[model samples]
Target chain A: MKTSTLRPLGRRAGDLPVAMVFLLPAAVGFAVFYLWPTLRTMYLSFTEYSLLAPPEWIGVENYQKVFGDRLFWNSLQVTVEYVVINIGIQTVVALGMAVLMHRLTRSGLIRGVLLLPYLVANVVVALIWYTMLDAQLGIVNQALEWIGVDPVAFFGETSTAIPTIALVNVWRHVGYTALLIFAGLQAIPKTFYEAAQTDGASEIRMFWRITLPLLRPALALVLVLTIIGSFQIFDTVAVTTKGGPVNATRVIYYYIYEQAFQRFNFGYAAAVCVALFAILATLALMQLKLLRAGETDLD
Target chain B: MRRTTRLTAVATILSLALAGCGGGDDPAESGGGTAAAPTEISYWLWDSNQLPAYQACADAFHAANPAVTVKISQFGWADYWTGLTTNLVSGTAPDVFTNHLNYYPEFAGKQQIQPLDDFIAADGTRTDVYAPGLADLWVSADGKRYGLPKDFDTIAVFYNKKMLADAGVTEEQMKTLTWNPTDGGTYEDVIARLTVDENGKRGDEEGFDKSKVEVYGLGLDENNGAGVGQQMWSMYALSTGWQFTDKNPWGTSFKYDDPRFQETVAWWRGLIEKGYMPSLAIARSGTSVNDGFGAGRYALSTNGSWMINTYYGYDGVEVGTAPTPIGPSGKRATIYNGLADSIYAGSEHKDQAWQWVKYLASADCQKTVGDKAVVFPAIPEALTVAEQKFAAKGVDISAFTVQIHENTTSLYPITDHASDVSAVMSPAMDAVLSFEAEPSSLTKANEEVNALFQ
Candidate 1:
């Protein structure tokens, strides 16, 4: 028995080499690409570099400029407003669709129809919305005229532009979010619902107590993803307004792009990037804590 | 504990894999191998339609010089600037590229563009071969010439002949029309009368609703940059004895707060207020004002001669070109915007790049390109060929050529922060046009912009 145990231990030790061989390429890739760049960006943020000259050590100057910039503050406000509004609306709309689709017998057709918008590229969505929202010749305004409502410049006005963009963002992603929630709904066993029904619980109570409680994990995942996606919003704003009508819709990423590419101010842009990463990391950690709290309460 | 360790290892590997996929190959090291092989020169340009003509010119140069090879690349105008600037900063810019006068200063200040003085001296090419006061415009403040003159453009009035006929107006009537700050000459009155409603009512008629009008006599888009909008307004402002700067070339302060400037803005704005022009909302929708004119949605639209080819291609539209309407300052003025071919200072093959640039500025290449009516070549001798080409195309473009000869002014001096200044000016001007602010408020905008320049 001792000889057999020793031989099995030797074989287990040999398996470690194979496992490392499988992981070596990926490990090397991550070290060279993501980790190195993140560290490099962090170092660069403390310097003054314009890509033309060698970087000069100017600790905290770049960071100070970022904080002092009114544009940066405006962009951050816009980003947060976009994230909160987008996440709230998208989550509710997605959940409603998922729940509705879950109860349907013909779920395949409904799910396929819902997945269509998610498959369309963001630029295409922007173009479609631009055409539809055009003030004079657009179908939306034309239809509004028929109803005796004055033509509204959906993108031209500062007040309506950001929300309109947010609405479009929510419209594009709702279907995908709903699909994720639908899968979570399916994974929850039917036996729980049956038991709840036998307890003579109302439909509303069953939904609140049974369905929502089980969906906590999926909800947490979707919420985190939506927030992250909303934070990085660039393409739609670029294609639609170009952050115009007096910079009403300028978001953080576009601001970063304008600095780095337009002004060729790489060091300042890198500082902004670092700050963005820190903010994202903090939000992610908070999400993890909230998720853990939810899990403990559920238990 | 064993499961947690395995998960950590997996996550670490995944993150490492992501990290490895980041930063591109250094361009400097990649192109070194081919650098010595046959002196391959790269040419960067933006216009797709003009690429064929450029390619033909490149072929001519190659035939003349068998040792050197030219490679041409095309990008959209915006991408061209972004890519050129990015590469310039990275020290891997193209050997030669088209440079706009407006953007030349920014690159020149950064030492991104090479001074072509030595090349011009070596070739013994006379600067007088080009238009007067044109060739010297590209020289930096340090007295270093940076680029070769390629083409020149001036703004003019493009009108629909059929629309004029429908309104009982003749081409002769348009030729005599003049303008002032307070009164927009006979042109404004004609525009007011020609602008029609669904019930065949004009802007000047009683019971004619400005909001409900079906057609506009004039089309103007406020969304355009100074390259277009400011050029149009300058015609009025200059005629009203307003100067964009204290001097024609390089004065420091803008004269927008001047009474003449205010009158010019008010006159342009009154077109919208009187319903002679489309509302700011409608004019901005769909295509630009040029497109609106092509679609026959407006009787007249103001544009530069560079877009003549674009306008001529439209069906059922009888196009006529005229000089800008005379303003109260007793002058019909046009802003002359030109383009040039500049050599990259950082280029390894400076000799070959200069050779190509000199060839472009030569009369042979200019005649070949300009004779096709593609553009008005900067070489003065090529003007005859260009005019003939336009006449061959069944339109006399001489109106613009004549306007430039008599009333041309160089675009505002190449400020170091020119793009930034324009960035501020464009939106501020838009705000004024949108009726959200007054023209005088531009002083505040100018102050903010001047602060940025400082």
Candidate 2:
């Protein structure tokens, strides 16, 4: 009797159009704003469109030229360097901050203070940091001079421009990464710590074993997100270095922006955009797979 | 299964709520009317500094054409172009707008702005009344005018008087500083003497530490929109017999590979290396060089005629004006940049837009704008009035007008693919200025720039 009653409800009532009616708006919005534009961009990658003029079909030409362009190659190299440096710094800094917050603060005040920088707008933060790091008049250089060190051109020289911009990105995002990691730390039960204590494990040993193993999911999420953000680095570089001192800090996104808006080469810029999307998607998938393998090993 | 359905329902409701809320308020009414009604046209401009003057002109325009009403709107520089481009594609752009030479070439070629030759012929427009080359700058490569010339600009060297005097540099010496392609000539010597170290030593001194500069003798305008680095290097290179291109108005190739340009670039960058000027890092730092001059951090700055008010606005600083230095050709050179008004191709009120642009280029509107001495107008009759107004205000702008009067000005290089050309040239120029590469290294970059045009 229970099977017969449940079957009729599942077969008949489930076929109602109410749910479809409810979901129609969101489906329309998704198609209009996101999905259609993305597909159009991919299509435009195969054409020659100069913003104002109607698109002219030219298959594979933009892609071929973009691959051969020296500036595009430089921008790609700079982007990879930026992503690697950023992820490395973010791992150390975010993990350290999370550990500090988990051990020292109880009321979440410390986490709030740490996450404040992340909440500030990127353009505002860029302007603040740009002023603070001035060679002659900046507060950072002034402090260094007081300590008997020569001034460093953080954003001006080719050797330092990419790293400096990466560090700024690290500074902006590390706080939020730590907050997430702290939540992960909170999820690990206190009983594990007690058990480790009973085993006479040192605090450092307990941290390496119990704390790190439990926090893997959060750390993986943070790493993947930070890598994606670093690869799309645009606003801070636009405001600070303007991809300059000879394109040292010109990341892939800034290059796309210049090609699209400044040079009005919409088709070439679309090809670059598609290329970046492919790279980011591949990277994210690899990271997830590696983490999945790690999870299986732990199981 | 229940969670997914509930989440989908929530998203649906949220999206509907947002979509409904967004259009709750309509865009403010701009006074639309029927086709037979009085013609109402919109005019857009970017400069807040010149808004009041143009507003005065608009009032005069309304008085002259009682049946037409101009609705004026002003936007900040970046917002103006971005918004214009958006409106351009949507076919909702202003009927009349202020156009820039940097953008007008592309706009004309793409037919985003209409040619005014027919309107000019109908009005019997006298282009000869404007400044010598000012009216001609609006003529495209195909010899059709798209804009009516409004005003022009020239560069000059602005100095802090007390700082120069303290460094033992005279006003006469400031005016006479000359440059050569190789040695940097007397111009460099002046910069070195004015540059002081923290240890009270000069840049020319034997032990002066470049790592510890108290003040930079020369201040660079950071992130100049034009890659030519107008105030800093345009005069120096042009005066040394290096042309921007092989031809003018619509040249297909750039001459950045010319050795004269390369040599001048090297000497200019050498200032950063020798501690006579600030590093590219410092120059790119957020503060404007104008502010540095105001704070006594920069002894000298190469500024344009448009910034006279900005120099005078500085507190506790005595501003001094001087002509640009003589160069290898034994002549003083400056860029004679002009501004103009244009009609959008998509406008329904094309005839009304033409009338506004013509009035802006005429002696009537030009004389009113010039008599205020805020800017040098394009009309020649208005030039005298502008100069007298400057003299009356105790601000002598002869440093700027001298270029126009003496006819020693080179036109700003207008050509196809300006933005792409700027992209290649600016970074190469930045490398030279930062002391990372020699100026001759620009040869490769120049080749890349020429490839874009081809």
Candidate 3:
């Protein structure tokens, strides 16, 4: 009803200098930190550099090796497993909390309680969880023992290590994600829900039909961010697992770190990083497209 | 006029940002060629226990040469390597830093560290002053001296005296414990006898529940010390006459596949199966071996001499150290590794850095450092003083020193691609230790490690 003739907005010549003045710092920062490092990583992927010596260009040799690298494939698979577990659980839990907060209570105190875990540093969260979930000495195990359960090797087993790490990260990130969805929920006009209620629609039906469709953009953002964050998991694995119980939790970033810092194989590490970048970029595009992040049904 | 004012503000902001980028480049602080200009030499080390000792040396050095000042910086072990490597790449590494045998080869190979032979020869610095093999370990494959020996370490067994007494195992029994790959010998027996279950039954008892174990006799660290196993099973393997490689300080191929080594690993793994040792899961459960020992979970922990003070620091635990068990070769062996000081090749004050390095390796510094009783100095006299200081603290260090006195020490496995070798061997060794793979898997791992050299 509020439609108007649409036209592509163009930058005015008069505003260019003002915009540039505002954008200079950010542009400089992006160029120095992000763009330059990305370009350098791409270039280093083709060379054999050990940090100590100058890089030696070797064409596609490093990439070729990466193709046949079993470790790379394993890391990618492990990272995918972590992402699936992390994103699936984190999304559902966050959505539930968001809905609960949106419908029941919108208190800032409750939201702050939800966001508290996210406020803690990743390293601190990891270390505290590592202590709590320890197989022998942790309080979690002691509690489990009291309830007739055998002690679980949370971070030590091949099957449980990545899931344990995923769950730990989920605990840390769920609150922030819930807050994001809660914000989206706030943006959803209450009139739509009120109308649906008057038309004899159940709460679940209205949620499925109206709320989900409207929540696409926020979900898409959460997915893309979390998927990327989950893939680059190094701190938890570094402190807890160190890619062990026989490479069970050797995520891509940890592999890259080991190659670059530990082994001094900077070129190989860079090549792996490029491959990770490609995978993440492709996944992000697919997610955005599938979610239709740009188009909201609000109009 | 308004537009010009806005442009001026923008220019000011841009200039400030650009100025911030250039703040790291301070050539003036790097010192000058002329001795008349006061020179500041930056030194770095990883050990915090040795910080006060080195700081004292810095004070003395400053007193001796008023024009030259030594500034010391300390970082934690893991951060030290990360910072050092990053700084080396960025051409901002300290002028002189403590170097490890694990990294010195790689640094020397890349020519990132300055060869100290020229300075040593020019100053007639006595390389032979250090304990046997300490000074020699710094000589690279190209026969260039890259560092000056500072301190040395050896492996020994730190045991809980209360646990030993409760298990009825005497200190003499611990000292004379012998091990063989075929049966695990007296060492295994002692470990089994010491291991206690939740029901208070020893591992050797008929109904001792392995699943309900309260205390493991032998403690294991996370990995097999990245295949070197310096503080884990290296002594056991070395005592069996199984050298890590054909030659150390530069070995082209590793001999991890050797039957002697494989059997040593197998026998060590058997301790896990028999419940004498904690499984890899419990060991790597984020509780360190020393912490586990202090908590009464581990009766004995094989550790390095560097951790001597740490083991002693555990409260409410009567700690004592014993020599490693003699193996099939009838010799009790320990891996002898020493730390040294090396100058960065890109250092601005090479002359001052060399002078600082010289002073750090001298008797003046070594004696002061040894007097702290924190570590064993490389110099024999300083080491003797350290031993005396340690004795004054009621710590019997003969368990660590007997290897040096008897010449039953093997050098740390120094090879190129040390981390690459670790990458291949750590998982393989972990698999074997974790009971996920067989010891024969190490043969394949050894092949892979050797392939790196090829």
Two-chain DockQ for each candidate model: 0.20, 0.33, 0.33
Model 1 CAPRI rating: incorrect
Best candidate, lDDT: 3
**TM-score to native of every candidate shown:** 0.88, 0.90, 0.94
Query: Candidate 2 chain B: minimum summed lDDT over ten consecutive residues — where?
Result: B24-33
lDDT of 2 at A229: 75
lDDT of 1 by residue, B288-354 (tens): 5665566566788777777888777666678997778777756677777677899988889999999
On residues A1-299, what C-alpha lDDT tens digit does candidate 3 reach at each position?
A: 33323422443556779999999999999999999999999999999999988999999999999999999999999999998999899999999999999989969999999999998767667777776676766678879999999888788877889999999999999999999889889889999999999999998998899999998887788778887887888888876789997889889999999999999999999999999899889999998999988888888
Q: What share of the true interface contacts does each candidate keep?
A: 0.19, 0.49, 0.53
- The number of clashing residue pairs in each candidate reads 8, 0, 0
lDDT of each: 0.75, 0.81, 0.87
Give lDDT tens digits, candidate 2, residues B150-225. Answer: 9988999898888888888898888778888787888888888888889989988889988778888899777643
How good is the docking of model 1, as DockQ? Answer: 0.20
Off by over 4 Å in 1: A1-33, A105-110, A146-148, A197-206, A291-299, B1-33, B222-232, B246-251, B279-286
Q: Write the per-residue lDDT of candidate 1 for residues A1-299, one digit (tens) a residue.
A: 77777686779889999999999999999989999999999998998876666788899999999989888888899888878888889999999888878765546877888989998777667656765675655568779999998777776676777887888889999999999888878877888888988999987798799888888887887778778888999978876676666667778998888777766677988999999999998998799678852462234
On TM-score, the stronger of 2 and 3 is: 3
What residue pairs clash in candidate 3, if any at all?
A: none
